[model samples]
Target: MPSLIRPVLATGSLNRAPQPTLPADGGLVLRPWRAEDAPAVHEAYQDPLLHQWHGRSSGCEQEAAGWIARWRASWETERGAQWAVADGGTDELLGRVALRQVLLGDGVAEVAYWTVARARGRGVAVRATTALTRWALEDVGFHRLELMHSTANRASCRVATKAGFAPEGTRRSALLHPDGWHDMHLHARVRGD
Candidate 1:
């Protein structure tokens, strides 16, 4: 009988990885969110598309500030990493890319991202997703990364596909939105894939 399991090297606690600026073409870069970025965060959340899919957003400066604070706390606790996708030249916020649901014990994590309206159709999400995936799989040593989206979110599907996440299957009624239960498309990528 062949062994069915491969041992994953333990990565230990997720100490904040040396916040490196990831590659982003067309004068974009991935960096940590800043206090002053609250306005941008607030503005991005104003897009109806974000509210439709995410179900929540920073409606005001206070909320956006708290949102950024939570992200910082998550980094401290090894729960997640949220990076601001920004224009490298102007430091203008374009969008966000994140690694969430980090289960180090299982060597797995999930990638999520959204682009502001101004950043849409520019491949910002795809590039940011790809960069984050590489950093998680290579630098952070996660064995697998998952990307799930509402089935109706075709644009997200494309982003996941372009970022090298292959669709596995659908999870019926996996998520609940404002309207009702939503079927989710599951996609995943393993290290070296």
Candidate 2:
């Protein structure tokens, strides 16, 4: 079975260098999550909106630390990448962004994110998503990137459009939240687009 298409992006490429800190507009920086951010992460999860949309919580500072560990390790594993959205001037934790379900051979991955209540409605998600998408598609050579969210998540839909992800279609009952199953809307960006 050697007669086949080669991988679009090599696996080791991502782990070759340390994950980068991406700078976005509006004085935002997307950096690697640090150990000390555990407390802030834990507190952010307490927001009801987070539970409503994400359906998961940090539960404790220790669990949040585990999240930090897992995200940091993902870089080395080359399975995914994540960043903490911080205020460039103050270095305050504000949100998170990630490329999840990365498939190097297919040159595709899913984009996901959330912002703290204080940072919402201020375009934080849009800026972070734009920065991460550029890095993933332009710098890292991914062919396509996906942004999927519940159809009920109008905020995420707005962020996707602002970040240049074109609307694809709706996937009926694609995800389960704490409340119930939700219809998922898929938005995507191809490299040349």
Candidate 3:
């Protein structure tokens, strides 16, 4: 008869590593959101177009605090990851870009982003999304990245296209928007490796 011992895994090895803070070009940075960002985030959420496009509600101070709290918990739990896009020089919150719904077992992740109204048309979303995708593929070791947008959101679709994501396909009634159930155009980028 032989006695067997089970192998023990290290605690850190069982957990997802924390994402690194990285800077993008044009004085833009994507880093973890600070508590002080709540006010600006709340204000950005108030934009009707953002709410309509992203399904985010207009938030008060308390709600913004709660949002930040959720973001913190998500990082701790490894369920998702969010970052606040800011001006590198002034540190002002410009918008948000998230690599969320990370399927660790599958080595895949989905990206979502929003830009403040004033920040639109400046290539902010493209730059932020590109930087995040690079981080995910190169640093985080993610094999695949996915992005989706409502077909009606031509601007967002353009951003996805410009970010080097290829159009995969469209899913009918994939998302429930303010108007109704909408079709979503799916895009994907795979790591060269």
Candidate 4:
């Protein structure tokens, strides 16, 4: 028996093509991850701060390649949408942005992203995330999008705020990092907001 509530998005509503590249302000484009980016991803994962925040490492280019393959496969599975934030002209990767834990029926996903060392202070994550949020909420019909980061990560708070995700509240001892459990701040944006 069907429930009373209607799905915010239909099962077959999304696709990877037709608008695969999401354009951002500045010269940034959010494109699908490529195998060639393994080296850069591997290198980015080596940053101690990134390692601490993400709690995972690429370990090698091959592993990063596997990750890229999985990111591509997610589009077909309708589980997630990941993008490589790259320069529109040079095609050099600057960061990554993703809609993770996608729930199509509910029209919700959590945003995730990271910027390379060279891109960190330049607002790459903010631009890429803003582009993705617009695409998901405006173009793709998601009802809501959420962003969460460790409270200790002040930079991420800035990115989330700048990207239009207003802080909802905090979850205590929410995530485990290498150091220990850390509290997280929840932020979100909804349709028409």
Candidate 5:
């Protein structure tokens, strides 16, 4: 029988998407995605790890470009933010880290990421995720950030752990995949955690 009402809002500085260049150890950079990255994105989607966990593929350069366009649109609409993790030395596309399911009013969001085959086993996902998490908590002012992964995706679980998202147990059959249902592990980092 608790109350369900809430206070009214003000026009805060949370509407616009933040553009930041986050640098990590060992020469990795997280920046906004670009249309010219379409080819690299299309190629990265060919990795079996991405297919196994994400269940979707860009398939072609045009579709990849379309994906980038959608990410850009989300920024303008203040719905989501996607970043391309690149090598600082060469500026080549290494992977992608994104904050999706953004609920600005509630100060909650979800993080997801994938690295190309060449970028695997190099801490690229972990570094990029850590940088994104810092920005989300400090600069973006979200109170809670979540990282969810299929139970079978051990690599992603490690990345989440390294990024300081503590495991909060699994949700039974929470995600549907190409093969069948997947139990997803819910990991999160709160503002004061």
Candidate 6:
């Protein structure tokens, strides 16, 4: 007969509470999405510029709710983090910035973001993206971060450049947009760079 010996457990809390949310930066805060954000998200999607740039149309409330639910789940699981950029004063959703495609083993990740049409040319995307990049590299311990933009999106390219991402190269026919197969410009920022 084999004897079973159970290991003793530590006399302390086995499960700790979840970490607090990311702190606000400057006058803008980037935090997890909420159910209430669906309306703003839906409206942002309705912008013609977003549809043209992102190749997708606006969703109904139900659809937006589902999207928000997925985002909340991802946040809880630590698989990814998506922020609803808001004005610190008014707390209105300006857009979203996400750190996704997390390769934990390789310590790498990718960034994606958009600002409402009304927020464009005001440095909203730039500020939000820069804040997210700093958080990913410093707080999340990501070694490499990359952003890919369609060759035709010169505005996005400018954002990447302004955010201190170096132009890595181009991926030929890397994305199939609404127009057709398009070349993608890759930009990257490495840790300590």
Q: Kindly report which residue pairs in candidate 4 clash with one another.
A: none
Model 2 C-alpha lDDT per residue in residues 100-187, reported as the tens digit of each score: 9999999999999999999999999999999999999999999999999999999899999999999999999999999999999999
Expressed as tens digits, the lDDT of each residue in 130-163 for candidate 5 is 8889888887678899999999989999999999
Best by lDDT: 2
lDDT of 2: 0.95
Poorest 10 consecutive residues by lDDT, candidate 5: 5-14
On residues 129-183, what C-alpha lDDT tens digit does candidate 1 reach at each position?
9888888888777899999999999999999999999999999999988678899
Q: In model 3, where is the ten-residue run with the lowest total lDDT? A: 5-14
lDDT of 6 by residue, 69-180 (tens): 8877765555666788888889888888887776555666788899988888988888888998887787656779999999999999999999999999999999988889
**lDDT of every model, 2 decimals:** 0.87, 0.95, 0.82, 0.91, 0.85, 0.79
| Candidate 3 local lDDT, 1-193, one digit each (tens) | 6537322222232145665577887889998877888888889988999878888775487799789878866777666778898888888787889878876656777999999888999999999999999887876677899999999999999999999999999999999987788899999998972
- Score residue 87 of candidate 6 by CA lDDT: 89
Q: What lDDT is obtained when candidate 4 is compared to the true structure?
A: 0.91
- Assess candidate 2 and give its TM-score to the true structure: 0.98
Per residue, candidate 4 scores C-alpha lDDT tens digits across 109-174 of 999999888898998998999999998999889999999999999999999999999999999999
**Roughly what TM-score does model 1 have, to 2 decimal places?**
0.92
Clashing pairs in 3: none
- Candidate 1 segments whose C-alpha is farther than 4 A from its true place: 1-13
TM-score of every model versus the real structure: 0.92, 0.98, 0.90, 0.97, 0.91, 0.87
Displacement of the residue 121 alpha carbon in candidate 4, Å: 1.0
**Model with the higher lDDT, candidate 2 or 4:** 2
3 against 4, candidate with superior lDDT: 4
lDDT accuracy of residue 124 in candidate 3:
90
Off by over 4 Å in 6: 1-26
